[model samples]
Target: MTDPSQTPSLDLPDGVAVTGALKPGYEQILSRQALELIATLHRELEPRRQERLAARQEVVRAIADGEDLDFLPETASIREDDSWRVAEHAPGLVDRRVEMTGPTDRKMTINAMNSGARVWLADQEDANTPLWENVVEGPMNLRDAIAGTISFTSPEGKEYALKTTDQAQLPTIVMRPRGWHLDEKHITVDGERTSGGLVDFALSMCASATLQLEAGKGPYFYLPKMEHYLEARLWNDAFTIAQDALGIPRGTIRATCLIETYPAAFQMEEILYELREHSAGLNAGRWDYLFSIIKTYRTRGRDFVLPDRNAVTMTAPMMRAYTNLLVRTCHKRGAHAIGGMAAFIPSKDEEVNKAAFEKVTADKQREAEDGFDGSWVAHPGMVQTCLDVFDRVLGDRPNQVDNTREDVQVTAADLLDVKATPGEVTEQGLRANIDVGLQYLATWLTGRGAVGIHNLMEDAATAEISRSQVWQWINNDITLTDTGEVVTQELVERLVDEVVTTLPGDASNYEEAKRLFLAVAVADEYADFLTVPAYEEMP
Candidate 1:
């Protein structure tokens, strides 16, 4: 065992040592000040706290006395690991390779049978289909598409034929059921009997072996509009029922839930935990979540309105806060946190498109920095860009291992302490080490094929590797020198050229536009660093 008192003193940078010497006195003063502030707050909050406690007690008493209450089932039970049995028999779900959303959004269907993505989900919710038409023909038309007539458009604009009619060939294509309604008895949709509720219909459509025999692989489902843990549990229960009814194992069917609400953000851990055994992974639903936040918070009052559609900005702090929380939460639970959608492509004008692409590349870099494994793009035109970004950010590093600092200890005394606890003393040294390390890694990986830099604090070797890589990038001209120079258009352009376009495209124009946008956004994101002008020059 290590001796706490005899702990080897950490060799801190000079500024940290100076601050460490001055911390105790400042800590003493801060403690007194905090105590007085807390007392003042306590006096103000005591009455409201007492009233809330009393109200909660009354509700508890009412429940104990058996007063009727319409309680939703608790999510905790479904969160247990053993709640669902994994399917022993593999379902014959066909891989309907291509997914297409029409301009009007009404005629979504799958094509390129047995090709690219493992499963294809025909997007209906965000499509241009009229609600009534969707209620009537959405599922039926999709069913027909699955049964036959599916085709794909090749890059050369020629139509490639699909073998969708070969029921024995392709994976199952999943569709959202229309007019679904839930009640006491059997759930009903479009005058047909659905096994349970919305969830039951979904699982049955995706998990039945007999269905798999007809469809090839059993169909898969995408659960959207998820808001809470209980919502996930409800879906789990439906899946359980469907699996049992079809004599399949409990967790046979797979599903992906869209995280699209603020409440969903808070409940992400519980939701992922509840669906872990059956989930495909979580998709970041950017537009829907934004709409939900506006509705939930009623943000229209302050003239702080978002651009209607075309001119909207995705770099708002709130947006970053939500997505960052998502990345952290998903990694915490060992589940994939897919990045947000970047459905828009840069314009055809080479300069404009290149600039747009550059901005997107930078945005994706930020997402990669925050810990997303992959992102979504609407067009095949954007696939090369997506792959380029992923390759640059993901590099040759092994799959990301969870190194989150959940176990890091923080205390009131530590917060107030002026002297470093032989750990970290000066804020500048800590900041410099982090900045230097990250910048170095970013530089080194600039033109490289896939690379990964593990958390240095978690693995001792990672620190040495980081130091080595940083120097390598510096030497190779892959990374910017740490001479602390102000970032200029030339620097941004160089970084873009080095990192953004690994694909075939005349992207110069797009690159320029993206660079301008990124300059503004990055400056805002790192205002403190940008303001110091000198820091820009720091190596």
Candidate 2:
């Protein structure tokens, strides 16, 4: 086959090498044409991605140096302009009241679609581990799913497939690629690695966009961890280029930016403005959002330090402000404002499941009442509860976009109101944090990105927040309210030892998990994202 990178239209980067021979199923998804599309995109977008990453550090430095984090003064005009509206949601995305998110492994791909949710987020990012098989097979699974032919049979003899319902009845597929900070080292161009986000988007779009369109959906995406509006702009331009190259109409590629970063929370309006033409909406995300805050403010002051991962609920002052601003900005721009994740995985224990269901019900009700057009669910079992909540509020309506929260007036102070959260640091919270982080990292290193922990679907963001809380507690010399114990390196090390001994998993993987965890949590400087260094050490 001819080299896709050699396509005359693409100016391939010199010396760029495509290492790691294609895996078993890679050819179907990573075809010559698909590779050329990825190469072309890397040539077009990676430079801007680098710049945006650097821009992120500038904001972080400013926050760390005691400079206030808030909406950009220069972009005030964009925020003030209220006339702009995003493109209409494509047909399949109009009623995303209950969306399920999971990695695109064969079993998950089939189950998520068959689950009664309205949409399935085929995640190649947080919900996915970037192993070689996962990177290549994920798109293959999606391509088949889009074509309505995906099925999987487990070794235990259970089989999963798309339901016999009409194509219109299946959950719409929205692909989520990796964030800017990650690299697809397995594939290289001009002897250097390309952005993982570009690789995931290009391969999936090239392989499945046409199939999705033929089935009434277009190439939709859930962009994660974008720190600036310009990053959204970069994505918008890439969408334009890819659509043009594929001969699809402009705006065919719709995106919902996950407002999961500290910087992004302050620029929701501006983010919509940048992606207006291609924007389907903005999503409120909590894990990575909390991680960003604790990661950035680990050293600033006690006020900036967060108490505990589990204790910091959406009712927290900063979280409330962020969600309110997200819904308002999205509606004002004529986009669907998706709510945060319902990570509860139903359990066999009746009491545990009952309590979880109650918590999810209240959470979904709060979001629906707050004007969220839709929300995300992690497992199939929780879908109906979410759907029911939205159904009660949105009777005979596709969305509550009309119910814009005009009363919301989130200011810089509101966005940074970390001190208002009513929670006290405690010994139990510290031990829980340490145990969760260690457990998550161990599973992550063993090739699982999303894990069920304490009946919740935890991901990279959970581990991030977990270890970050420990680091902040240790660095700030925080005292536990219940035990009166001051968090110190000695105490953390002792806790880590105890947790590692009790952690369930392969013992060797646990050791590696602990080493990586300490590198980020106990180091002199904070790791921007835990997965950055962990990705390198991914054996």
Candidate 3:
């Protein structure tokens, strides 16, 4: 933990304090204007943010007490009305055939800009570890990125910088802020911590909204982990206030909400309706969606239990329903329905790269055939693979939003058909979960949010899926299909111990990672999100 007395304090706005150390250039990112924007939003909407969070817990409690999750009756009219549509796509967002996502470190900022994707999801949420330095440098790097002066030089004397010669070829920038459940403890507003989402949004807006507008783009975002339409309303409220404060146009900011939560899957239309004026579309955040399924239904019987994370692919019946509904909902409302992430990172082994590319190609092809506008890729090498798939389907066209998918019909039961998913739990699967959970936590504790584990780019969402599956399996008394061994606390702990020995010796935070993983994986009451408790342990 950082001591307030040791950090450099800034001349911040009234009722705002900088508890984190401010490096020399950080003052420009957290300027008085930015602090004021965050402070104002925090004061006005923090209560409502708290209320929405409380509402989430209430829904969880209701579910535990035997209430079924379904579409909102109060917002049925919004879904029924066919006259409303989201605002038109801003410049550079119309043809988002491929998007690359990564944290805003200087090297990644430069690389993603040059990755040839149509948009770069400059992610500060799942792809970022919110160290005080990252909190400050994220906006700083983005500011430089917009200014077209971002560069990086590795310790080995290699050079990297943005492609300034052809400015038109650069990808549009879309930022993803932290979720509502998180607070920026490094900064305080009115004697309380401010929402990390608000902080990231404010600083990004203050630092680059006008610059991006001049560059033919506006303040664009990808919103994460919202459970209710009311949460979407709250985000729309934040976008309104931030844009007005920054003097941008009323709907200048466009947000693509990740329909990752189970309850959120049911409220897709309502969420779009709430943010229709400032909506970009919905994304199939598949990993987090899986994690949400396990978390939301963990307390239920074996009917809701999920098998290994890897076993539940996009082809699963429930997942197929989720994505099909997303594409239909977005097209019905004139929004662009984006696809899920392809996390395969190309490697040195030719056979490995061959198999991974084949899988990625098939995945993107399925999404395109389902009428998706675009999709996400984690590495630069796989950008062309996604581009080729979407290009084949969307040749000479920007997006396929005209196809409303009217023939597709999804019921609530279809979205909840976890029993139809094919796959069996094996001892190997459980060991993989334990290994991945501990490895991801260790790297995260060391300030890396995106790590390559077993050739796949693992993020916080993947880790959540890993740990949550362990908890759900243990709680539901799932037996391993291969070994006939029941999943128990003892089994998981033993696997954790065995996996720790095989972990990389250079993983500096190994022991804490082990402890943190077990804490969330075996606790009597499951942790809401692993990052909430893990944030307290961050340096």
Candidate 4:
């Protein structure tokens, strides 16, 4: 075990401190040079990050005060002209058929690399709870993996090590940092907290950019939770500075932005324009997209209030509009349009696995048919099914970028037609939402960010959709068609208590989960993101 006392005191910059424990060998990843570069980025980019976050709050306030969400009339010409295109794909990122996403712990790193997927998103964001040990240890594992020396053996004696043969078939490593809205309280610049997104990005980029290039893969990223083109502009600027400082070529780093925010959904063209020199593609951040819509319009009437989380399929009128717009916008601008997550995980029971595969196949089939370049799954078991569907469409070809989806034309009304999604608010949906929220939260409290729930992989975003939907349903007094139960704070508490009986775990953990769950689920103001509060409870 690494001793905290033996490590030399880091010559941290003014206003910064080692808020988290400096584990053994933390110095290797947090070298003096890397710290200085991160400080430079924090000093340079954090203020802009604060401004962008304020801009997001302003939008939320407008929607809260009866203003309708719509496209920016000012940037319509960028959307109309349609002549510009983002930079071509980075060399290693050309054929992304099945990208798997997970927290960047040691075991997940080895398995994800060997998952037979085209890309592995080393997530430091939604899928990961920012426990300090995890925050520091995650990159250590990645650094080793990049150097072909990563291995881990469990206490149970199950051993894992990187294989040379697997290296050739391993997924391209694309790191995803935290979003702009979060602050890295552990590190500060001039007594102010730095943006968590910049901290994760800077540390990883400063450490790995040149080395990745040497390995024939430029530093690639998946930008998450951006609410505007201005945020993308900020990242592009940061990329230039980092590259120049590191002596890497300009435009060598590529990023794929997740258009998860409702406001950003309207500015796809402008977002790509801002990152034109370094664009990879955009993602249909489907789960978070639902959470975003609710966060924006929770106070609006029933029209904007969604039915149930399960009922909002990709084919729902508004969802179809969003996905269709993504493929069209990305293909037209010469960027990849990656699809959403297939959260299905297999099981021991043949019948159970069969059902999961059937659901996942139909989902992947639709995405493949709709012109998505690639999609994601939660487990390795779902990879071949996604590959087969996309393979039938993209036989002998790495990608289908040449298939520009010209038949798609989406208007702003189509995007804002939230009430058009058909489904019933019901007793079953309410119980499921509450149950999923609590179950996932319990596991997260134990320092596990991703858990299998109902045979599907559930991440922080899954719980976000759950908790937010619960709050939305309660605030709206949504009526359940099946049981005629009106969702209320009192009723929700009762249901949570009932769910406690069903969840299999220590009573203490479930007790903690219940208390935290209700605080977010029953609060008058929507909690921005569950991970923010959950991180406070971590060791």
Model 3 lDDT tens row, 1-539: 75656555566888999878666677888899999999999999999999999998888888899887887788889889999999898787899999999998899999999999999999999999988888889988988988888889999999998877244678899999999999999889989999999999999999998888888787899999999999999999999998888777798899999999999999999999889889999999999998998878777788888877788899999999999999999999999999999999999999999999999999999999999999999999999999999999999999999999998899999999988888988899999998888888888988889899889888999779988998888898899999999999999998888888888775455888888989999889999999999999987
The lDDT leader among the candidates is 3
Clashes of 4: 0
lDDT of all the models against the reference? Answer: 0.41, 0.85, 0.91, 0.85
> With candidate 1 superimposed using the best TM-score fit, by how many Å does residue 294's alpha carbon deviate from the native?
1.9
User: TM-score of model 2 relative to the true fold?
Assistant: 0.96
RMSD, model 1, all Cα superposed?
Answer: 25.0
Off by over 4 Å in 2: 1-16, 505-509
How many clashes (backbone atoms < 3 Å, residues ≥3 apart in a chain or on different chains) does model 2 have?
7
User: Which pairs clash inside model 3?
Assistant: none
What's the distance in Å from true for residue 342, model 4? 0.5
Q: Where is model 3 more than 4 Å wrong at Cα?
A: 1-9, 165-167, 506-509
| C-alpha lDDT of residue 357 in model 2 | 95
Q: After superposition on all CA atoms, what RMSD does each candidate show versus the true structure?
A: 25.0, 3.5, 2.1, 1.6
Per candidate, the number of residue pairs that clash is 41, 7, 0, 0
Poorest 10 consecutive residues by lDDT, candidate 3: 2-11
Worst 10 residues of 4 by lDDT: 162-171
In terms of lDDT, model 3 sits at 0.91
| Residue 372 displacement in candidate 3 (angstroms) | 0.3
Ranking by lDDT: 3, 2, 4, 1
Superposition error at 334 for model 2 (Å):
0.8
